[model samples]
Target: MITLRDVVLRRGVKVLLDGATLTINPGEKVGLVGRNGAGKSSLFRLLDGTLHEDKGEFQVPAHWRMAQVAQDMPETDQSATRFVVEGDVTLLAAEREVAEAEASDDGERMAHAYMALNDAGAHDANARAQALILGLGFRLDELERPVNSFSGGWRMRLQLARALMCPSELLLLDEPTNHLDLDALVWLEAWLQRYPGTLLVISHDREFLDAVTQVTVHIEHAQLKRYGGNYSRFEDMRAEQMALQQAAFARQQDKIAHLQKFIDRFKAKASKAKQAQSRVKALERMERIAPVLAEADFTFEFAEPANLPNPMLVLQDVDFGYPGEDGAGPATIVRGVNRSVLAGQRIGILGANGQGKSTVVKTIARTLAPLAGTVTEGKGLNIGYFAQQELDVLSPRDNPLEHMIRLVKETTAQGRLSGQPTREQDLRSFLGTFNFTGDQVFQAVGSMSGGEKARLVLCMIVWQRPNLLLLDEPTNHLDLATREALSVALNEFEGTVMLVSHDRSLLRAVCDEFWLVSRGGIAPFDGDLDDYQRYLLDMAKQAREAQREQARAAEPPAPAPVVDRQAEAQRQKQRNEQLRPLKKELAQIEQRMAKLGDERAQLEAQLMQATQDPARLAEAGRRLKAVESELATVEARWLELSEAIEQAGA
Candidate 1:
């Protein structure tokens, strides 16, 4: 357990926490959430002993082992598997001890060293590391590749895998999903669900928090407030708290108003002079209640299209991919493509990494011309395309105002500018919508943070007033507030939107339907996010099985070694005894889960049809939520029991 009482933490002159206190119990999963600069990361630093409190008590058990993702990128030439396996320092050390003891011909020491190695699971630690890598979307062949050959984002994933590989009692992850795709993110959630540790994570992703956290700690106004349950529950409780606070404040204001009115009316009268004085004293004695601070409002709208088109764009027999090197030909990524994006349609592009999600987005944006087919667009079509790579769309030397100004000049030259000529001040005022103010607007793009750059790109996109927006991972670096702002803007926009993002909350909020990019083809994905998650898990399992089959096929046949049948039989009997209870529990949980899943699906169907009456819809929604939660819990338990059974058999 960790405890902090009246902790005061500061950096330079900025006081992050003022008398903030909180307790975190063992084996609890906690979400530390706040605004971008609200000291969430700083709190992690304090916990890891990189920072010290200026006042108050902060305590953690000295014997607790901690694990966190490394901030620094690895520039090593080591194999990726080896790099990840080394994250378990204790296991590696024990293995080294056995090797050294054998070399020294110390039989007694060698025996002790072997026992330590077995206790640390040294033999299978590499397998565990590889599993983590696979779960994080790494290919089997890439496991033995040099770590330095991977890109920066992938190296960060390697860091995450390393952190997970480490054996620890306390785990701290800061935005672990930043580099992951939706598939990998789903896999991570399941992995974290089974983690038997005291977990504290800092994440801006609301859905991730809701799925993994049992408690949410919010830092606001230099104070820490703890809420029970997940992020959604926290929001509900916080909204109620604020509402009551505001109501009490309104009542206090009304009482003060009546008292002041009486005093003002009677202060000049002779008989009522004493009463007025009493009223004045009473007013002085009254304590003022602070008004509840409402959440910051973010409202913006995309401009109406210059001309409405029934179908914004159409792709017929399109073979979309990158142009081949040296003017050979375009390499087909996904073939036999046929899609018609209609006006006011919201589509989500879904696929695993390197599976053509972005390729499809680029083809729609017309940045990459179709190899073998035509892409037809409506008359006077305007597009607001946001590339996944922020730097690709933004100039390093240009400022936000310059980007907007350049946009105006380019559009005006192309005869795409509407209404009247725009001025520099207009661009500056528009940039303020994204929280850029004063001298910040004049700063170079290279100096800006990732979030700031993302905002600037979005500002430019919205300013174009396009009828269609092709946004690829727009919320990658955005905070929760900005994400909400974007969602609201997209909801209100009278245009089409195509999104490819790992942020499930944003995807669920904005996308009306989904198109899956898989196996070099595009098709409609019929189910929702939950079904997609199951699909990803099944795909991973299939991949693992295929790899095992491939390895077996490649190996040369060998004669079996002589076995001790009696000992094996005894071992099998012991394994069965150990696994009996777990197998029974797994079967029961699976049965319950199937029933709950059916219940949820039925309730969801009812919800869709019950919207004519608000009461029916609300009740159906409530039942669906409970059934889904129960299903998730049971599924996690099944994973636990299955893993236990497998380990015991091993």
Candidate 2:
């Protein structure tokens, strides 16, 4: 159990929580949601006992063990598995005690140490750590790799895995899905679902919150407000609450206005002097409701492109990959691909991590060229590419204004800019749209938050006014509001978009078509996200089976079976290709379920309304029934296929 009563939390001079009270019971999976900079992290700090409340009481069960992701990036050359295993502090401590006891050869001490180690489950800790690592999307081979060898995103993932490895009663996860691809995200969800401990997660991912969190804790106006049920339920409830609050606020405003008017008219009059004085006293005594504010309504738009080209970009017999150690060798990631990007198309690219989704994006964005095929771009084609690795585009030391200015200068030098020299005023004005204002526009890009950096990147891309946009995980760091703004902007934009993101909300909102990048090839997926999830499940199962096969070493390789092996490889590729549409249909069914869920919620909300039509209520119920029937059929097929695939993979 945790309780914060009249708690005043401050960082430097800024107050985050002032006289706020909240209670969290044991085993509650709470989604901590707030606008960016609302001190959600500070609250986590409070829970971790690194920060203390300036006033009032804050309490947590003394016996409870807390586990949280480390704030710093790991710099050690430690094996990934070792790093994760060490997260079990109890196991580590027990092992140390056992070592000490053995060194002294104290029979009693050694006996006690052995018991403690056994109790701590030290023997199986490594296996548990490995499970956490694998669930977070690490390859089996990579588990033994040095931690320092991985990229920043992978390192962050490792840190998350390490935290999950810990045996704790309370777990704090801050943006755990930040670096995850869709497949990894789903895996994490499943893993978290099975966790028996209490969880308080800070995330802007609506789908994730809806899936894992049973309760929602919202921070607003320096106060904690609790809502029952998942994020979807919270949103619905919050909307209603805000509506009622706003109505009461409006009424209060009218009353205040009337009193003020009367006081103004009678303050100097002898006959009404007493009445005016009383009115003034009443106004002074009256409590005011804070005006409802939409948390930083962020909205930005991309200007229409100068030219729209059919088949804006084409990849023919493309074999794209990275160059090897020597200039003579090139390693292939995606091979034998054929695709076209047409003007005004919104294409969502989906795949498991390391399956060439980013590679395809890089190829289309021209960051890397196709190894063995021509990438033909239509005349006058321009690209505004948002790299998943933001550092590739953003200069650390440069200010937002400086970056924008440099972009214009670079474009002019490259003969890509037809506009006049960019003015500082124009740049600042543009940067302001992204909430970079006043001195903020002068702050180094490196000093900003990930969400801010992402916004700055988008700001730069918009300035380019490219005909085509290639966005790779653009919503990774964006809060729900900003993601919504981006989705709306993408929907409204005239240019073609090729987006690679794990954000289902963004994909559903912005994309009309899906492309599955898998098995060294890219194929058009005709299904929605749910089917993709099913496909991912099958893929993961097969991968696990492959690992098991490798570990068992049950079959010996034969040189004469080359043709059979080649044929097997060919069949696997064909099988993946064949599974694409079924995945798509499953995805459509998933999408339909989501829509039906939303519709049912809306109907229920309307039913509670005094003004709702009875006929409309009946019609809504009928539509819901029809949707349920269709969903049942699709879900049945989904189950049948899932089982079949599972058996086949086995």
Candidate 3:
């Protein structure tokens, strides 16, 4: 457990956290959410002890270990395993001791080294490392690959895995889901949900937070406030806060206006003059509702394209993978995947990180060649692909308007539209729909915030009016408000959409079908994400019950009493020292196991519901099996750990 008492953080002239006092109990999962520049990251750093506060006391238990998941990559060429395993500084010291003992060839030193290793939990460290990495979406081969080869996103994942691997009492994760694909994100959600250690995660992914976190911490006006529920519940509270403030302001204004009128009418009367003076003093004393941060006005409307044919895009047995990256047995990111996206079908892809979600998108967009498969385009179908990292694709020198014009001209050149003049007003209107206002439209795209630039990129895609849209992680850089607007626009869009995103809320809101792109094949799940999630939850609950029953069955029926009090006391003393950390770890792991079980059940139920749609049902079934397999692994590990603890206790 960690506590912050009147902590304040400052960055140059800006005050980040002002007199912030917060206490996080053991095993609490808190979601840190706020608008851009609201100091969520600053507050996180202060809590994690990475950054010192400018004022006030930060109280953290001396023995409580903490780890933070940073967004950026560390400058290192070490393999993923090295990056994570090296995080256990204590464990590393034990390893060094073991090496020294081996070199010295001393029996006493060797015995001490073995005990130290056991205390550090270094003996089974490799197996633990493998589970943590796999849970975070890395393959066994990628575990030994040099981390330098990974991009910033993948590096972030490595950082997250490292943070999770560390033996910590509290975990501070910032945008933890950013680099994760559908599968990894899902696993992470379940992991965090069951994590027994205190956690504070800063993320824009609503579903991720909703599924895992019970508390919501909002940073506003350089102060920290807590809410009882998740993101949606926080939004409701925020709305209520705004509404109450508005009402209070209205009453104050009304009183002031009435007082002014009374003052004017009764200036000559002594009693009335005193009353006016009192009113003026009251007005001066009133603390105005901190000018409600102007919420951006958003109205999204994407112009519909001309009539398009059914079966907008078709792929038959497509195979995809990064040949050398994931290892060269064809890598096979996705195999035997066949999909037909028809007009008006909004599809959302879900899977773990590194589970070929993006590969599926790239294959559909023809940006990456399918290792072996057939792709057929329906008659008159036009596709526009939006990469998750689209900022890299933008010309820094060009403004939003220029980029829009260029894309329009280029796309129209193929006679998709004959001599249709680019409409500047239409462009502006589209930009406005994405929350790009007057000056924002003219500003250089590079100068805009990530959210603003994302809006600009989305504006360009809408401007193209392609019959089929392939959007990869469309909600990545977008703010909550903008994401909501986007949800509306995508839902209203007439074109078929194949979107790859980890945002479950957006998927549920906009997608008519869930297209699961994983290790092999494309499976579609017809039905909303909510239902799918529900199915997963149910399946996990069932699994947990089964696991509990099995554990009970495996236990001996007869009980044993302490035959020797002194001997038992000695054994208890030794056991206490070893059991403390192990018990703590087991509790954390068990929580995560329960959460994972819930998710597996939900996916299974969703698969069952989607049986009517063969393609979708198949995809759901595949994902269900994958979830079950992952659940089994975690369950087995938990059993092994629990049994080990029981032995240690005996």
Candidate 3 contains a number of clashing pairs equal to: 20
Cα deviation of 117, candidate 1, in Å:
1.8
Over 1-650, each residue of candidate 2 has an lDDT whose tens digit, in order, gives 89999999999999999999999999999999988889999999999989999998999999999999997999999999999999889999999999999999999899789879999997788788887788778899898999999999899999998888888999999999898999999998888888898999999888999899999999998999999999999999999999999999999999999999999999999999999999999999999998888765999988878889898988889998987775678989989887888888999999888889898888888888778988889999989999998988899999998898889888988888835338889788878888999999999988888999999999888888888999999988999999989999999999899999988988988899999888888899979998899889898889888888887796766567446878888888877776776677777767877887777677667667767677887887787677677767867787667655554444
lDDT scores in order: 0.90, 0.89, 0.77
Better of 1 and 3 by TM-score: 1
List ranges where model 3 is wrong by over 4 Å: 1-8, 70-79, 98-113, 149-152, 282-294, 297-299, 314-339, 351-356, 369-380, 395-402, 417-453, 526-650
Question: Tens-digit lDDT track for model 3 on 365-475?
Answer: 877777887888888877777888876458877888788778777777777762334798877776666667788778887787777777777767666667888888888
Quote the lDDT for 63 in model 3.
81
TM-scores for all candidates?
A: 0.83, 0.82, 0.73
Global CA lDDT computed for model 2: 0.89
Once fitted onto the true fold, the runs of candidate 2 whose alpha carbons sit more than 4 angstroms away are 259-281, 418-421, 554-650
- Highest-TM-score candidate: 1
